[model samples]
Target: MPEGYEDVCAEQAVVEGGLLGVKVGGEPVVLSRVGGQIYAIGGICTHKPASLEEGTIEGGSVRCPRHGGCFDIRTGEAVRPPATRAVPTYEVKVEGGRVLVGRRAG
Candidate 1:
């Protein structure tokens, strides 16, 4: 719905307590729906080169499958061991049943 936002998938694709991996602007991004809200973050684990889509949704965080690293889906902050770098976060919005992903968040 805004500039730099690209349609990634249907809103239903990101189910509650689940993770959806997609590419936005040629960058890997993971979309998650928690507590009825949608969030976008770098799809790769900061500690390793693992796809976060293969990870599990633990509450409001995404746990890397390769390791036990965790990152806050809302802020992209590393919250667990093995990961000390923060992943990039993106802007997300739902419109017309579609999930749109925008530029990296600050």
Candidate 2:
């Protein structure tokens, strides 16, 4: 575990197709529960200042409502137009019924 990054909340708090915005270690992150798996990505869209939490999630991707672009919730890949940069993806873990999000492990 990284210093200053700790458990945020329980897994059950995030429902399927749900979007949540949280800050861990001063970094804004958007957490999404897709099909039963949780994915964490940088909160804002690359092309605009819109929050990804306002977008819709389908399958493993999330679409930004502001610019109509999409990002792969898994790899953070910018899968659509207007977004050429991939958002950062954090490592997410569920332990003791809590969801812990943090930086990528080495």
Candidate 3:
């Protein structure tokens, strides 16, 4: 694996249309699969420090349960308010059935 990246799980651990929350090096992250593509994003809502896992996935966006705000999973864009700041997105890779997540070094 590359630097700053850690293996999260096997590909099969996250089913389609499902979300998996995990901590990588003490950073909270949420992984989800949509349209056969895996997406990794910050697990906390931008409006407040709350777990994003409480929300529901709707198509390409995940709805914030606390304020009904929505975010685009692909680009981590704040699609609705109560959350104007965009959430952080991570690079995801599937190698030999293992899922890995990491922040690319600039």
Candidate 4:
């Protein structure tokens, strides 16, 4: 999202229990390590731009802190009300302890 903001490391994606949320280009990005795979998605609630990182992460979904809206962390699909819009999801790739997020080039 920012200039020269690269992906995160595979190790950094996970510590011991779950994935890690990181900020890239001033935007919140959720990084999940599920089943040994890394997934990246928008970490902000679409309804009011609430930080999803501070919300609950369960069953591959992240809940909004502002409202009770739920979203699929992998697909960025809003699964509940109060958030009719879907957030942006990015493609994640792990290489040699490094994770890379794919974005549309300008």
Which wins on TM-score, candidate 3 or candidate 4?
3
- Candidate 1 lDDT over 1-106, as tens digits, reads 7788999999989899999999998989999999999999999987989999999998899999998899999999999989998999999989999999999994
Predicted candidate 4 versus true structure: per-residue lDDT over 1-106, tens digit per residue: 3345475555564643254677656667877776666777887788997777777767777777789798876678888888888888876666677777766221
Residue range with the least summed lDDT across 10 consecutive positions in model 4: 10-19
lDDT of 1 at 76: 96
Model 4: lDDT to the true structure: 0.71
The residue pairs in collision within model 1 are: none
Lowest lDDT sum, 10 consecutive residues, model 2, at 1-10
Cα-based RMSD of the predictions, in order?
Answer: 0.8, 2.0, 1.7, 3.7
Tens-digit lDDT track for model 3 on 1-106? 8777899988998777778898877888888899999888888998987888778789899788888888899999999888998888889989899899988321
* C-alpha RMSD (angstroms) for model 4: 3.7
TM-scores, all models, native as reference: 0.96, 0.89, 0.92, 0.78
TM-score, cand. 4 vs. native = 0.78
lDDT of residue 43 for candidate 1 = 92
Give the per-residue lDDT of model 2 (tens digit) for 1-106.
4453568778888888889888877777889888789889998899988999899997788899898889999899999989888899988988778899877531
Which runs of model 2 end up more than 4 angstroms from their true locations?
A: 1-4
Point to the candidate with the largest lDDT.
Answer: 1
User: For candidate 3, which ten residues in a row score worst on lDDT?
Assistant: 97-106
The lDDT values for all models are 0.93, 0.85, 0.85, 0.71
